[model samples]
Target chain A: MEVVDEGSDGRVARVSLLRTPLFEAHRAAGARLVEFAGWEMPVQYEGIMAEHAMVRERAGLFDVSHMGQVEVRGPRALERLQWVTANDVSLLADGRAQYSLLLAPDGGIVDDIIIYRQQADRFLVCVNASNREADVAHMREHCAGADLVDRSDEFALLALQGPRATEVLGELTDTELSEVSSFAFVDATVAGVSCLAARTGYTGEDGWELYCSAASGPALWAAILDAGRDQGVGPAGLGARDTLRLEAALPLYGHELSLEVQPFEARLGWVVKLDKGDSIASAALRQARERGPERKLVGIEVPKGGIARQDHALLDGDRRIGTVTSGTRSPSLGKAIGLGYVEPQLSRVGSEIAVEIRGRKVPARVVALPFYRRPD
Target chain B: MEFPDDLKYSKEHEWVLVEENVATIGISAFAEHQLGDVVFVELPATGDEVAKDEAMGVVESVKAVSDVYSPVSGEVVEVNDDLPENTELVNDDPYGDGWMVKIEMTDPTDLDDLMDCEEYQKFCAETSG
Candidate 1:
């Protein structure tokens, strides 16, 4: 593909200080580059669907170094985190990670993050690349006397995901990864680089996310690619990443879960603990649980044809009910699937709906969440 | 990319091969490369009248959807039905198997305004850069 010099505004400058160790490697590999959140990231390498299928069938590598990694240290770190976040952090043990949400005073979602308990006093929080600065600022404001450190620049993260990911990564390390359960991590080394291997990923596949130093990232990435070459592990970019996550029904920050939407409305009530010993949003969550959400997030599957895109109007007969938040033509399912907020009464499992695509109403059904689930 | 000297080209990156009054229309190699990994193609039906430089069909890729323009004013005589399932033929053999439609040209003199292989190559190079 030919590189066209297209310039936009200073949107890259206003976000955060973007840093990635694999910028040169991505560019050299003929990746079409774009500014995502402050970082210049690869949108596609060979093609979107090809990489998307590879991650579903075999293995794919991703330079997730752009995601923010913040460390909270000190004796009262866990206690402080539990008060500020919506998840029950007391249930987490050392080396275990939990998906949690940072909530505002009114119970709105600030950001969705994965909290990894490294030790009793130390925790690693991985947030979206676009919300890094705001997340850090939010953490500092809630920390009070706790030690809050932004380790995003110092560390680089890589995700090796798919069915063969474990086989490829296990060959490189001396430690056996067979015992590591899902959402559990182990401290180890890869190619002499000190790394933390987590058995967690966004794709609905068995995989590991390796976090290492920024300087050692390039070598570690090359080593993994070299080791997994025969096993069909290829470099994947943001396009595949988006499709994989969407198929799994994961909520993206700007799309499903945002500061304007509450966790209850987004159907993430499981993460928000209402009885976790008096947080600021506890009373509000309790009230929300009692009344239930007016609008609920649901999955819609288009049966015949047409693709449902963002901002497309969803209807029941002639009455407009809601709008699609995220939608795509699922390459795996060979059909169009989307997520949208609809009236709670109409958000049932076999509810019929219509999505207006290009002035035509396509038939769709509100099916169960997660249009695709990985076989265990 | 090679543009055969015998073929005629349109500004919208469509090529025309006129044999008497029957003209075969397919997108240029540049167009196929630009719209990577063609997933779905909407073809014009046979017996449909098409205007010159007008949209005759639509091609969808993973990234974007583009309209395929007709190079000559004519009636669609035949359409490539294989492209609906195997749209990647556009990327593989754009000139041969990827021919979108066959048209019975209303006016064969319209081919004179189209570019030859040399002129089309230079036009693509200058515009692409």
Candidate 2:
């Protein structure tokens, strides 16, 4: 880790960033490193477009070690989780995962998370890197009787995703990965390393997210790459990750889910169980459901010449509509795609809208999300 | 990495080739390398008037969009018609076919603020380090 100091004026400040266990491996592979969530992580290994295409066509490996993991276990773990989470945690059977959110008192999202049920009294919670500490503190404040342990640093997570991911991962493991249904995981061994392999991914592709010891990250990464060498498996970075997830219409913590934005407006109302009795923020959320959301999150498609970057305003012929949350040139679609909030009436599938891109009002339209769904 | 001795460079990494009063403009090799995989390019119109140190056009990659700044104030005479469709020219041949626009200079004295090849190379080094 490098601690760089900035003294542009008289005052001095020190900035030190943490690194994943595969930091040296990424450096040796000639990746462009960037600061993400106080961690030094790779933004790109090859070009973003090429890597994006690779993940869609073949398999790609991702080092998602920056994501935090917490083990919550006790006699009251299930009851405690149901109290803090927006989703009904009681519905998940053992080895099943549910996408849920931690909400503030005002029904604003604290962090979107994945709760993996390991047993009746135990669960593993996966959280975004930036919100890990805050989420832990929030959980502790609410669930004092439950045992909460931060295990983010103790494990490294690797996501292998694509159309060919099953075939590639099959070569190294004896388990029948095809039988493991979506959002379910099993304790398995891959490439001679023990891992909890889950059939879940952010890329909206058929894949497995392997959670193993931090010390085994480098070897596991190399072995998977080597095992899939003939299938053109490559290491993907944050740049490709963002584009892939956006095409899937998955909400990021800062961009789509935030402390200011409530769940219903972000198209996350399905995850909020207002009828689930006595949960945090459920009262405020029930009132919000009674009074429908003013703005709804929709997909935006721009024409030629302009790329709709974040914070660009959405307009309906000079009428202030909403603001863009995240935007990028879709490598798979070969067109401009973005996510933004707009008035509910304007959120229809083919409503015509325009986005302000660099002082010009480019022609845009509200479109359906999950812009690039994989072939069935 | 290749900065032609006959050309002048700006801190924004644009290169200018002054042929008499008209200055031809393009991004340098370093800029193209830093912005990998050029996906779109928007050049100024042929008759548009451009001001020095101001945005003249736009270049977009997969992740970001960057504005191309003019090094000399001028009236655009010729624009790159091939670049909008063949954006890879900016990354492949940044000095030749990748040339963005040719402008008839309004103030030729703006060339005094430009850096030569050696100076531009040193500037890139210091900024990168």
Best by DockQ: 2
Candidate No. with top TM-score: 2
Interface RMSD measured for model 1: 1.8
Q: Which stretches of candidate 1 lie over 4 Å from their true place?
A: A1-19, B1-12, B16-24, B43-56, B69-78, B102-129
> Model 1 over residues B8-97: C-alpha lDDT tens digits?
999899999988899999999988877777776777899999999888888777656788999899899999989887888998899999
lDDT string, candidate 2, A168-194, tens digits:
999999999989999999998999999
lDDT of 1 at A188: 84
Local accuracy of candidate 1 as per-residue lDDT tens digits, A267-347? 898898776787757877888888899888999998765677778889999889888998877878877788998888889
lDDT of 1 at A220: 92
* Interface DockQ of each model: 0.43, 0.74
Query: Can you give the lDDT of residue A277 in candidate 2?
Result: 91
Q: What's the lDDT for all of these models?
A: 0.87, 0.92
